[model samples]
Target: MSSSRTARWILAAVAAAGAYAPAWAAELPDRTPGLWETRALIDGRYRVVRRCFKQGERSAFIDAVGVGACSASAQKTIFGGWMMQADCRTPKALLSGKLLVSGDFGAELQGRVVTSVTPAAGGPVVKRTAMTFSSRRLGECATTPRG
Candidate 1:
């Protein structure tokens, strides 16, 4: 066979392999859960959006970015949004952190106003997180909404 024919066969084989990879890796979950958007501070430089799911008995926290990242801690509070206790609870969180949504989804940070966030979840999509925080913070500097 000519070299051209050999190359064509190799390309066809590669294409076939590529097509099946995703199908094989596809997850068949017992429950396909819709994630709730939670507000979280990321790296103290920007804000992030996160989601939580029930993975078996334990809750899972995920940073909703271009890529998915699992978070360690998620807490639910009185309001909406979330305060990622994973690493954001620490001081270094200012530099590197992600908003985890689990335990409590978008409940803690609903009213708390802070400087920065990570993973940067912005725009009209998560207006709830933004609206609640800005309304309380800018609306009144002194008597902030009680949690």
Candidate 2:
């Protein structure tokens, strides 16, 4: 994929990371189970995606982005949200990021995740990327029949 495309995907994944309730994994607020609309800004362009969260699916977003790909190290409550530090290893680079999440979370949420990517080959240069995103509850999710 093109570098721009890759950056878009990475931004989407980072945004998805904030959409779901990863309370068990990172102490994030328990997101209401429903359909959510997430809008992200990457490279001065905006992209939107919608996701449906079932009643019992807690880690769906994390899984969609690639399970275990990113790990949170430290997190603390902020005035209207939370701040966290995370690290991940991508195919070509290692990423270290600080994520700031805010808003009530029941209806609307917003945050920023800024990352510095270091080439895995031990390069002398590092690339930094910052993505901002917002998510809102769209409504209840459509139900599916049990197998």
Looking at model 2, report the run of 10 residues with the lowest lDDT sum.
15-24
In model 2, state the lDDT of residue 6: 47
Q: For candidate 1, give the lDDT.
A: 0.24
CA displacement after TM-score superposition, residue 102 of candidate 2 (Å): 0.8
Per-residue CA lDDT of candidate 1, range 29-114, in tens?
A: 12122333333232232333333323321122111111122233333322333333222222112112222121221122133321
Model 2 spans > 4 angstroms off:
17-26, 56-61, 64-66, 144-147
Against the unseen true structure, what C-alpha lDDT does each candidate score?
0.24, 0.66
Error of 2 at 95 (Å): 2.4
The numbered model that scores best in TM-score is 2
> What are the models' TM-scores?
0.19, 0.75
User: What ranges in model 1 sit over 4 Å off?
Assistant: 1-33, 55-58, 61-147
lDDT of 2 by residue, 87-126 (tens): 6666776667677888865678888877677776767536
**Which ten-residue region of model 1 has the weakest summed lDDT?**
128-137
Cα RMSDs, all models: 21.3, 3.4
